[model samples]
Target: MGLLSVRNRFIEKLRNFATLSDPAEAALEAATRNASKLPARRDLIREGDRPGPVFVVLDGWACRYKILPNGGRQILAYLMPGDCCDLHIGLLAEMDHGIQTITPAQVATISGGEMDSLLTDHRGFARAMYITQLVDEGTMRAWITSMGRRTSKERASHLLCELYLRARNIGLTDGIELVLPLSQIMLADSLGMTPVHLNRVLKELRLSGTIQLRRGSVAIVDPARLAQIAGFDENYLHRRLRPAIAG
Candidate 1:
């Protein structure tokens, strides 16, 4: 399929995630016009570089993150379909983080010049993109609290719960049975714990029958129990319930 076709399909998927007014849709279509697609594992954009064109994840998942001196990585965010990977660039003094693929993905690049043009022409587009930035900031604050205050067990479960919420927003999860791609070691880095410690906590969660992870798939055996263990809360995502969509 062509870039426009991919964009149209992504737009359809996004309607389930957020209310994109018609003008917003037009603005997005403009940015996507004459775009190029990227295969998975390609560095669509990197940290510490001038903000280039925004990337639309036509399919699959990507992560935005930063690496510490010892090579530890903190995944700041995951971008799914209907989400813009560099929408926050306009607000940043410089790029301080990097993005990479987690799953096989098809991506479309929209030039910064076109984004600037759309901001002037598409009021709703500007509003939606700005809202995306605000949403990211709020989630970052939650991560700070989770990593700093929550227990290692809480930290992992919280991340799982959070991904569940995000995956739902992207119409990927059905409110449960979400898949987390990162291994236990990756989980440790994001939660600021040693891999050994993270593995220990995972064992505890599994033994308690609150959750289970096998073959890279996570099954919430007892969501309420799991929530209790990790102090998971849906409020952090700030997403509209799927059932709330209008007829």
Candidate 2:
């Protein structure tokens, strides 16, 4: 894709939090103009590496994860198109977790100097970026809740629901169909279940007419039903901006 298109995607995600001024938009466009493409299953950054330029996913999917000494991996979060891996990670001395691409991905790197200027000179952009971080934290909390309290079926359903909505928000969905690009192994790892157990849960969902899974894709046959089974509430995503209330 062209640079303009990439900038538009980032702006689209930021608009979910705050309105951007002309300069803010221009700054982002310039910062993200140069992008590099990486093949699927490539590691963008690894644990213990020194923090460098903040990486943004301009296209395809990436993930935040940590691997245990036992060779087990735990996926912490999914990074969709337009999602930045870490906007303010410059303060950290080293990466605590690794980031890897789930598909052939286009990524942009914003230097610490440019990031500082964007945050210092652009109030609207800074506010939007801060809120974006807040939403990321909220998403992590939701994932924790899913792992600790939800059953296997509920976890699968909830993840599907969340990915569908997120894809829809970023205009990646065609109606209720989403191009998930995720393998069963990746999904199983994200949901904290064995591949066999996740396959069973997906079978149950398909049998119940909640969703239909195709190669690297999913069609939500009954969105409301799927959400109901997952007991999902989109409030945690904070897609809509609410006015500040007076104290």
Candidate 3:
């Protein structure tokens, strides 16, 4: 795609919260111009790393995770295309979690100076960023609720539903199907379950005809039924504005 079209795509994401003015578009273009194509499994930021540039996922999947003292890892959230990571993290000295790509991705890095410019001169863009941050916080809250209250089957189904809805919103889905690049181990880590247990859960879902997984793709056969099983409420994702999914 052309540069203007690429910039417009990023602006479309911000427009989910507020209508963008020409100046806001220009500011986004300035920030988005420095994207680098990163390989899959690359760490964008690491725990205790001094915070610097903010990252925007222009394409592919990435996630935020924390490592426990026992070397166990918990995936906190997934970052999708049009999602910006840590919009205000530069204010902090270091990151408590790290961000890594699950697939080869085009990641745009906006420096502290550019971010300051957006806040100082582009008020609309700044407001959109604030909305995005609020949505992220809401997603985290929902994830915590799922872990504390939902069963393993419910947790996995809920995650699948959330991701499917999000991918659809971003035009990444073909009908009810989308690429689910997560491995069983990664899904288990995100759900706080053992890999073996996760396998059983997937088998059950498949046997019941609730979903299908093949060649790194996921198809929700009956989303309504699956959502019912998980007791999932999309409201927590803030779908009225920019809808996002949790990991």
Candidate 4:
């Protein structure tokens, strides 16, 4: 695809929740001019590596995770198309969590110098980036709440809801259906459940008319009911901010 299309994806992602001025749009497009395609299940950035360029997902999914001493892994966050890897990670000495591709992906690497110049010269874009960071933190807090207090059923349902909402906002879904590239094991790891238990919960949701988990896709049969079951709150997503739309 062309660079303009890739930049448009970034614009679509941020414009879902925040807006940018014309200068900001032009800067982002220029800065993200060159992108590389990444194969599925590859490491974009690993734990303990020196911080590298900021990654912006142009297509497909990636995730943040950390490996435990027992060889287990916990998935901290999911990065969808148009979602960026942590921009501030460049400021750290070493990465605490690793980012890896969940599917074949297109990624743009923004060096610290480019990012600093963009932020310094474009106030509106900087504000949008800051808001994006805040929203990411809010999502992490919600994940903590899910892990700490939600039941297994609620936790799974909440994650599905969260992913659905996020993908929908970025125009990745049609009606109630979207491609869920994750395997059962990945979903289980992210939800703090065993594969068996996660399978059982998914079966339950399927049987209860909440969702249909087919191969490579998830279809919410009754989003309202599912959201009620999960007690999902969309306030933290913050989909509205003031700025002019750019071409």
Candidate 5:
């Protein structure tokens, strides 16, 4: 009773879900309905709302942010394709932040009605979605560690390297270059630094011969040296991607 035609597109994506029996086929079928696809900088969802199915980030970068008491927006996290965006909130009673696009994006919103149906009908799907949120929680812990313990320069480099690897694995990056639309201001917000400080760190990386960043292109002159300086570990992402139903 689902869209049976576009099964091929879901394989690579659902392979990371672990609970998907036939990732390529079942996941494609599950993605039957897409309401509206909009460009970035639009609000996809907001805070203080009820839980829903999930937004399967089909493409582009989005960030969850909350307005602080001081009238500043505190960016919580960045969501990529395969990320559940608000999976944690969906399981809970309320939303804490608003999810908005950062780039010209493509997002498919899974319907709440369909989710209600899944909880009643598809145990496998329900369980998978729950675990996916847990996976999300683990990543939050890692982000916190990176921000609190690591230096600002390392934090900035770490986040960039993380995005590069994620994009590369999904065929978005070729390892040499990353297409990032984020401004230094946004980078400062995400890394908990000021624009002036971020520029200094970026300059340090450039002077050290580790990275060349301009416009949308980011080239790691020394990938290993960059990783060493950033203290990045891709274990959280890669281990999550290891095929559950291996061939």
Candidate 6:
């Protein structure tokens, strides 16, 4: 696909959170013009690396992760098409976690100056960016809740539901089916499960006719049933843009 089209996907995501004026859209277009292609399983950024450009996913998937002392990796967040890695990461002295591509991907690296201009000069863009960060925090809270309180099966279901909705939000889904592009190892790491245990949970979900999994895709056979199992609520996603707060 053309770079313009890919960049439009990022614009589409921002539009979910705030109305972007024409100049704001043009600034984003200019800021994301420099994109690089990465192969699957490549590290985009490493822990302790000095912050550089803000990375935006143009296509394919990437993840935020950290390696534990025991050498195990914990996947923190998935970066799908149009998701920005961190709008304010430039302020950090060094990265505390790593980011890696899960599939062959296209990522745009926006320089700190461009990012600062967007945040300082464009009110709508700034609001959208801030709201995106808030939504990211909300997602982290939900993941914490799942890890600390949910059963293995519930965790699996909850994650699938979240992925499905997120993909749908960014126009990545076709009906109830979406490309997952994640390995069992990746999923297990994200869900805090052994691959063996995750396999069992997936089997049960399949047997219950809640979902159908293929090589790189999953079909939600019964989304309502799946949501019920996970106690899924879309509110945490904060899908709509609310009125801006008055200073």
- Clashes per candidate, residues 3 or more apart or on different chains: 0, 0, 0, 0, 0, 0
Worst 10 residues of 1 by lDDT: 238-247
Native RMSD of candidate 1 (Å): 3.9
Q: For each candidate in turn, give its C-alpha RMSD to the true structure in angstroms.
A: 3.9, 2.8, 4.1, 2.3, 4.3, 2.2
Alpha-carbon shift of residue 84 in model 2 (angstroms): 0.4
- CA lDDT of 139 in candidate 2? 94
- Tens digits of per-residue lDDT, candidate 1, 1-247, equal 2334444545654454456667767666655554445655666667777777677777667778787888777877777766667654656766888888766666677767777876666554555556566666878888998978988888888877777767766656775577666777667767888899988988888899887888667877788887787777676565653422221
Looking at model 1, the pairs that clash are none
TM-score of 5: 0.83
Candidate 1: which stretches are off by over 4 Å? 1-23, 33-40, 88-94, 241-247
Q: Give me the runs in candidate 6 sitting further than 4 Å from their true place.
A: 1-7, 242-247
Instruction: Judge candidate 5 at residue 9 and give its lDDT.
Output: 28
Model 3 agreement with the true structure over 93-160: per-residue lDDT tens digits: 89999999998888888888888878777667777778889889988998998899999999999999
Over 173-202, each residue of candidate 4 has an lDDT whose tens digit, in order, gives 869897899999999999999999999999
- Global local distance difference test of model 6: 0.89
Q: Model 2 residue 204 lDDT?
A: 96
Better of 4 and 6 by lDDT: 6
TM-scores of the models, in the order given = 0.82, 0.94, 0.93, 0.94, 0.83, 0.95
User: Ranking by lDDT, best first?
Assistant: 6, 2, 4, 3, 1, 5
Decreasing TM-score order of the candidates? 6, 2, 4, 3, 5, 1
lDDT of 6 by residue, 1-247 (tens): 2333544678888887888888888888888777788788999899999988889989888999999999999999998888998887889999999999998888999888888878888888889888889999999999999999999998999999999999998878769898899999999999999999999999999999999999999999999999999999988889966635321
Candidate 4 regions off by >4 Å? 1-7, 244-247
lDDT score at residue 21, model 2, on the 0-100 scale: 80
